[model samples]
Target: MAFPRVSILPLLLLLLITPFSSSLSLSDTITKDSLYQLCSQPTIRKHFCIIWLTNDPTTFTLNFYGLLGLVIQKTQLYGYKNLAMMKSLVRTTTDPMLKIPYGSCVTYYESAIKSMEEAIKFAILKKYELTSEAAGKAFSSINSCEADLAGRNTVPSDVPLRNIRFKRMCNIVRVFSDVLTAKNY
Candidate 1:
């Protein structure tokens, strides 16, 4: 009984100290729980969701610095259905103009454009106030992705799987960028 009491004391102390060790900072985006409470207010919920949604895209930029690990975590939470579709399209396409095993790298590019367009629309409608320049920036990301696709496709060799993956990852980083920069979100 004495030994068990001593052991429990140490365990309890460890648990208490573990939580207090973390530092709080404002650069941190507001928490989901708090955001949810804000959302319940009716007037602010849409803006709240949109703001969080928009913040997701700017995550991939060269300048991205805030809460890097958390940003990735949120993007994962969003679950890239579009990105997965784009990846599958790129992986399967064999022709550039028509359909073969896939359409080569262009398939991914097309999917990206489609996805960004939808994301912009999402921002403009529910959280229009949350997005940068009111979805204008998100719109521009589509064009930038297009330009990037053109460059990658032109550059050179047959689109390897690695190349496809790299384009898929790097270009979508802009999604987070547009979101974060968007004034409303």
Candidate 2:
């Protein structure tokens, strides 16, 4: 039997477009469960990660890099908050002992904020190692601040809580960056 002739162009176009379209849709369909799975990776606090990421509506639309960027942004904001708190402590406290540690915290948080900004830039560029390094630096800064406050007998209760939360955010960035690096994405 003879077959009717059909153009191969349409078949070629479909073949070329299938993979790209499917991948695009896969990325676009990111949901809360997928985010939870990502956040539930070992060494990450699943609950904390989920709550923070889901708090912003835009997070549902982000891929891995975008999610990491959001975490870095949150870390930067927390750094600024800590800086403001330290500044307030330094200004309002009459005790020289309190002033010494709070003053140091002010400097540390300033450095942390700078590091977070660097992390954000590196994350955007998909330089996962650099992003992790920047986040680690920010984490170290928070640790230093905590240590300084530890020696003081009159440290404010809220200061410690803020430091803990800020450190957690930095950890999330570091872990997520490491995952991206490992995947070589």
Candidate 3:
């Protein structure tokens, strides 16, 4: 059987566009997977990163600024939860040293939540540099709180492990911000 004659112009256009379109789609998929992998890097909590980063479809579409907003939101949520637990400890603990450090931890987590709020606003405004700096400070504050608890020999068994999740989330956002900023994306 013979095929009917086709216009070469349309065929040429299709040939030209097909590879470009396919490659673009493929790259997007690769980028999404890379994000999941980057989020689950050795320094971070792999399972936690994988679960959170992959839970929503929008997470894959976010630019660095948008990603920063998500990170800030998560940080605030975690900080608040941890703060409440610390407050409970402060209220219940009989040991003076434990009470003081737990109280201090509550204060630090509050500051972190405030800083993360700032980071979220900056990210929303597309001010990634400000967002990065704010997030970095927030991350540092949590680290400082953990350090204070350790120094006082009042560190909760869960605080260090919990901080690892915070570190990973903040660090991933920082990495994305750095790449986008440096590339002027």
Model 1: per-residue Cα lDDT at residue 137: 39
Q: Please, what is the whole-model Cα lDDT of each candidate in the order they appear?
A: 0.39, 0.83, 0.67
Between candidates 2 and 3, the one scoring higher on TM-score is 2
Sort by lDDT, best first: 2, 3, 1
What candidate 1 gets wrong by more than 4 Å, as runs, is 1-33, 36-69, 72-84, 90-139, 142-185
Residues 109-136, model 1: lDDT tens digits: 4544454454455443534333223223
Q: Which pairs of residues collide in model 2?
A: none
For candidate 3, report its TM-score: 0.70
Model 3 C-alpha lDDT per residue in residues 1-185, reported as the tens digit of each score: 99998779987687556532132221243356556545543445667777877776777777544555676787778778887887888898877878777778788888877887887777677666777787787788888777767765546678777766676677655555454454444
Scanning candidate 2 in windows of ten residues, the lowest lDDT window is 20-29
Regions more than 4 Å wrong, model 2: 1-29
lDDT of 2 by residue, 34-143 (tens): 67766766778889889888898988888666777778888898789889989999999978878888889999999999999999889889899999999999999989
Best by lDDT: 2
- True-vs-predicted CA distance for residue 156, candidate 2, Å: 1.6
Clashes (backbone N, CA, C under 3 Å), per candidate, total 18, 0, 0
